[model samples]
Target: MVPDDLLLETRDLTKDFGGFLAVKHVDLRVRRGAIHALIGPNGAGKTTVFNLLTRFLSPTSGSIWFEGRDITRARPAQVARQGVVRSFQISAVFPSLTALENIRVALQRARGGTFRFWRSDRVLEGLDGRALSLLADVGLEDQRDVAAVELPYGQKRALELATTLALEPSLLLLDEPTQGMGHEDVGRVAELIRRAAAGRTVLMVEHNLPVVAGLCDTITVLQRGSILAEGSYAEVSRDPRVLEAYIGAQA
Candidate 1:
């Protein structure tokens, strides 16, 4: 069980695009070292919430606290520097580069340098070694030299994970990390995500209910830009409103 002390909390979080409200007032929390799943139908304000967290879209009027700091108005880079980062559904990898090279670039970005010493092959090798170790940790060491674009679909996803892990984030915001894959691939990615969940908090927006049931300690259901229900899988699944909006035969 995750401790009650929060790692992320959104108080009346909201987002408006010109006059249309993309996301309504939202109150959410993610605890340290917990796999919290956010599930909802298409256009259910899931992505909007992620954008707000990452500061991609400024909230209209609300507060966002991360690791106990108010960051509702932080810039995207500022938020990333604070260890709040998200993984994209589409691979954000450098497809032209080898897996090791991709991770090397991310490592330098994480540590805040890559172009400092031009002639130091030793430093480059050190960076390569660290990237290799991280790739190995993500079970992608065998493909270290393989170009990211040439990898299979699942492998591309894995590469994306490696790049994100290189950021060493305190909280991971994953948007459909297992989207566009087969059942076997889904299970594999789920396992990989579980492996990556050590020592950090993870929050995901997933439509796969089985994945949510298998991995989430708590699930929040959203509909029409508001949280419809939230609780244990069984608890929320049994709620009449959730059933009607997202859990019944139609759901």
Candidate 2:
């Protein structure tokens, strides 16, 4: 039985790619309204776990439960509709669309799982207020009129975050939300994530340990596709196995 406070759980999750075991016997638990992080060196299968959770890739064995429902075999769209929305490791945005428009597109999809491109502008305008609010939530309000391509790299990522939030996900899955970001941009985006995490659960795969240390309430370290350590940042950082395998001398 899943605890009332747990929002997502995976039991003995494994993924086999031909003869390669990308992920093996992984158990992940994400508590409701907490910021959790998956961190590891390359080839640790952090992304693979995210794919399995969202059904982008099927696990060879094991089951995934979200909100107490088994979703091991749920379709990608079905998982998304269940309020599990993921942001990719790369910045994904409509280049030509303004920040507000990008968010509006997500809002439209969230409404009925279809983009009503044929709908009259006036009809779609109803979503503008909500879209603008989402943009503001991610600190993109000032870029509302700027095309995604015109925004700086950090703002582009922020816009992507805004769009993801527009879906009203109960569990937000962020894949390297700060990848390729400058120092300043990292801090900004981190702050945005902290603010956006209010009242919702966040599960992120992040490489920047500082960002993980600052933002995540619980940290799960992976090594060779299996969990190495799971605890608060301070606890995991001090774990001898975690330090030797993943953190090296950094801890």
Residue 38 of model 1: what lDDT?
A: 93
Candidate of highest TM-score: 2
Residue-level lDDT for 162 in candidate 2: 86
Question: How well does candidate 2 match the true structure in TM-score terms?
Answer: 0.94
Give the poorly placed runs of model 1, Cα more than 4 Å off.
1-4, 115-122, 248-251
Each prediction's RMSD to truth: 2.1, 2.0
The 10-residue segment with the lowest total lDDT in model 1: 112-121
lDDT, candidate 1, 1-251, per-residue tens:
34358999999987888887767888898888889999887888999999999998889989999988999988998998899889887767898999998888777776655567755646556688789888887678999999999999888888888888888898989999999999988998899888888889999999888998898888999888899889989998899998888856353
Over 1-251, each residue of candidate 2 has an lDDT whose tens digit, in order, gives 34888999999999999989999999999999999999998999999999999999999999999999999999999999889999999899999989888998888876663656676677768899999888777777888899899998888898998898888899999999999999999999999889889999999999999999999999999999999999999999899999898878344
